[model samples]
Target: MGESTAPILRVNQLNKQFGTGCRQCNEVGSRQLDKNYCTACGTVHACQQISFDLYPGEVLGIVGESGSGKSTLMRCLYFDQEVTNGEAFLTPYKDGSSNLFEESSQQQRYIRNHLMGKVYQNPVMGLRMDFSSIGNIAEKMIAAGNRHVAAMESRGSELLEKVHIPLHRMKEAPKNFSGGMQQRVQIAKAMSNNPPILLLDEVTTGLDLSVQANVLDLIKHLQRELNISIVLVSHDLGVIRMLADRTMVMLDGQIVEQGLTDQILEDPQHAYTQQLVHSML
Candidate 1:
């Protein structure tokens, strides 16, 4: 076995705020002024002084209630949104390391298309509702320059099997599946290119408890076998415990507490974390 090492991702002093100038940031007022409060209609601080690392094959869960900017942070890491300041890095399980923000736009696009994948909170949004599940996955594969359509088709089937979705449903539109099934299909699509890192945003939020358990199990199993790093964002501590090796607790755009999974779970530090734990119990 390979010796355990450092994080696959490292971020330091990451600061991102919406809008332009202080006057604009302030016009919106103090209610929105994050501690790192920017100077305009600073809709959200998004993230600030957010330093952390993610190891290869480790699941790093981001826990924050709604409006805490977890999604925005995730988007910034993937370059979906602009990051105002600091370092962001990712060393994939397969490729040379890269500074996500420092890279050229072409390089960033290449990484987004070929090495990283993201799943949205709502499955419906992750896929093209008009296309069949197979079409959706294959279309993405082809767009990413998977030259052989046959190989991609075969791979898509394998993915479907892994997710326990029936092969026959491949040609069927995702609009027909139950919410849980749709989620599984989206997982299959996201994994189509075999990315080394995945962003799972509230993947199980809407499912029933039983289905949620199964989805969590599936995510864990896939992570182990694929040797992929994952950033799982969830407000649910139970979900975090099920999949994360480490946890980061965020409140209003800042990471208030972060550490190994057990440490955070057994003895949380921040008052917000304490309150969250109390609410859960």
Candidate 2:
């Protein structure tokens, strides 16, 4: 199954809405929402009928301006936010028959610990700022069922080294680290479980240009080394260009265009996508 051409992850008609389904909100069709918001019912149609596939060892990029629902889509996939409606499947879960969104909380927690890794745009969202760097990674391993302290400690040390975090700081809290370092630690913690799919949301958003380059390089290297399927969300085209194998351009909570990254950049088909491409030039 590892070498099968089937996608590692599949999503269908995913939707996330933040409001009561009042008559007023129901009257505002998804197509009519302005910038993902409905004026009539004050509803935020964060993600509307989003659908996509992520293949093994593929870097699938989701790009959109703020409020375009890219981040909302990620949050939904990671179960950070509940999906109002949709189906998500992991190839390895119940032999691909189970819908992730419908799983029990216990089952969802297990899957989150053992099957997926998520890195948030903000370190505070991903890391325990008050905990030692080693502690952060250990928390993941613990969730994955590691009971031996010595083994977890050793694993944490090794992952920290892998992410280029200095060993001397293993006992230091991440609150004292720079933004780049905090992100590295977050990556290390996310990878601790060795999940087959990684969800990264704006991992390089606020870092220095040089730091962003280094982080991007590290991601590429790890993708090759681990062969993990990656879902990367970013508004930055350059980041998408540098990493994604395929790109999806989103607008107003809809996928305006999607294709090979180069094709999307060089021959955008949608008006919104064309505008994005032209602005990048």
Write model 1 residue lDDT over 140-183, tens digit each, in one string.
79868888978988998999899999998889999998888888
Q: Count the backbone clashes (under 3 Å) in each candidate.
A: 7, 0
TM values, all candidates: 0.90, 0.95
lDDT of each: 0.82, 0.91
- In candidate 2, what are the lDDT values of residues 181-203, reduced to their tens digit? 99999999999989999999999
What lDDT is obtained when candidate 1 is compared to the true structure? Answer: 0.82
Winning candidate number (lDDT): 2
Query: Considering every candidate listed, which one attains the maximal TM-score?
Result: 2
Candidate 2 residue pairs that clash:
none
Worst 10 residues of 1 by lDDT: 23-32
